[model samples]
Target: MKVAIYTLGCKVNQYETQAMEQELRRRGHQVVAFEEAADVYVVNSCSVTAVSDRKSRQMLYRVRREHPQAVLALCGCYSQTHPEDVEKLDVDLIAGTGDRSGFLDLLEQAAAERRHIVALDRSFDHRTFEVLPAGGLESRTRCLLKVEDGCVNFCSYCIIPYARGPVRSLPLDKAAEQAAGLKAAGYREIVLTGIEISSWGQDLKDGKSLIDLLETVAAAAPGVRLRLGSLEPRTVTEDFCRRAAALPDLCPQFHLSLQSGCDETLRRMNRKYDTARYLQSVELLNRFFDRPAVTTDLITGFPEETEAEFEQTLAFIRACGFARMHIFPYSIRPGTPAAKMRQVPKSVKEERAHRAAAVAAELRKNYLEGCVGATYPVLFEQPKEDWFFGHAPNYAEVLVKGTDLHNEIRPVTITSTDGEFLYGTIKE
Candidate 1:
């Protein structure tokens, strides 16, 4: 069978899609591109926002229309949260966030019988983490190791908590074992990703935390560069920072989630931390690591967000000086609490997003300028035009003029920046 998968949303979705692809290939099925003809088409959907849900529907509709004869499957957050909507589509098989292996089994069964199958379980009933393969295809230099799944943080703007349920973590030993395997497989970097990595070990009842898991994985993969996914600001304490800083192979880049920097907006959003706590996390990372790249997410024009509140957010981001930022205009997600609140005008939302983006651009430029003249060991990934491109430990994209530098970690002395990427030369 020829199976093609189209993934949407966050890195966890990407990781799950890769795992499914590997499983299909292992079963002697050919995995094809979404644009190509196939016997089965899987749309791993995302419902983080209404726009994300729309895109998932668009992809599913497109695949169904283009390939009328193929078996269409819908899974992930969108289907998990809104199965009724997904059922209206011409999909042949439907599975929620859990049980990818079983979903594939149903796919085979549906293909054989030409029948419709729906397999979904209550999200809250889930207690164990679904362990999948850790790496991508052999050609990739970096792979993601999902150390945890699910979220209990029911922020007012999020639908993920309901879609993903409570935290269920991959055991420490299993994570270490996977890290060792990924290292042996010649992966240059292994990223620790999840729905909420900060909540790892909560379900284990072992009194261990994310830092413990990090130390274990670092020991398991001595030479592999370890990168982390988006973290809750509360996770960055003195103990966490100190232990994490001790890991020699850990990348000095942290992505702390900060939706709004204003205290009142944060209160309405039900965020666990305020601007002061978020700033402390940034400061702690900077103090522990040498100019560590601190990245964040910002939502502009949230429901009832006053102009003064937006200004406060801008000021707060400037104070933190993020290395990079993902700024979004607030979009109403139907099931989320923020959707029911007094809404901001769409024009105002977009305008605020533009302003926030301008600030983000300035901060990024400043951070990049600060990188000049510093030397970093860059892990080369691919070549473009006349240069091989890779990322430093700080996750800065660095380009050096070379050929066949893929998968090689070479010390690169930064010479300049074109305001977007760092141009450097290999320190032979």
Candidate 2:
């Protein structure tokens, strides 16, 4: 069977899609592009926002329309939260957030019998981690290793906790082994990803934390650069920063999840930390690492977010001066508490999003300019149009004109800035 996978949303979803493709290939099935007609079309969907939900449905309809005879399967957050919704799309096989292995089996069976199959369980009932393959689609410089799954944090605006479950971590040894495998496979960088990585060690009875797993993976794959996915602010303590800073291979970029910057808004959204604590986390990282790039996500126009509150957020963000930021206008998810709250008008949301983005743009411009005249070690990933693009240790996208620099670490002298990216030259 030839399979084409269309994946949407977070790094974790991308990791799972890659795993599914690997399984299909291992089972002697050909994995092809989604545009090409194939025996099966797997849409690993996202439900982060209404837009994501619509995109999932849109992809399902288009794929089914394009390849009328092909078997269509839908999985991930959108399908997990609403399997009935996916079933209505006339998919041949349907599974939720869990059990990728079983999903593949059912997909095979569905293809063999030409039957529709729906397999979804209560996401909250899931307690065990579903281990999937740890690498990427491209056999290249960087890969992702998902060491955790699920989120217990019931943020007022999020549907992920319901879609995914409580925290389930990959055992320390298993994480180490996966890192070793990725290193052995010639991957130069490994991004530790999950639904909520900060809650990694909560389910464990033994004394273990993300730092412990980080130490194990760092030692296991000394040659590979270790970067982390979005992290909760509470994880960056003095002790955590000190230990993590000692790891030579760990990348200095820290993506702290900051949904809102106003204290009142944070309370309304049920965020675990306030802007003060979040700033402390930012400070800790900067104090520990040399010019660590602090990045974050900010949501604008929550219910009851007054213009004054929005101003506070903009002020707070400017204070932090994030190197990169993902700013979104709050989208109401039907099942979440935020949906039923007093709504902000869409026009207000858009206005605030633009306001927040302006601050973000200014911060990004300053951050990029700050890199000028500095030297950075970049792991070259791919060469395009006579320019090689890679990332600095702080996770800044660095583009330099070079030849044959693939998978090699080279110091690049930063010469120019493009607001969000740095243009540099390989030091002779």
Q: What is candidate 1's lDDT per residue for 117-154, written digit by digit as tens?
A: 98977888889999999898888999999999999989
Q: Total clashing residue pairs per candidate? A: 0, 0
**Candidate 2's residue-wise lDDT over 134-197, tens digit each?**
8866557899999999898899999999899899999998898999999889998999999999
- Give the C-alpha miss distance for residue 132 in model 2, angstroms: 1.4
TM-score quality measure for candidate 2: 0.98
- All candidates: TM-score: 0.99, 0.98
lDDT of 1 at 155: 92
- The pairs that clash in candidate 2 are none
Off by over 4 Å in 1: none
Candidate 2 local accuracy as lDDT? 0.91
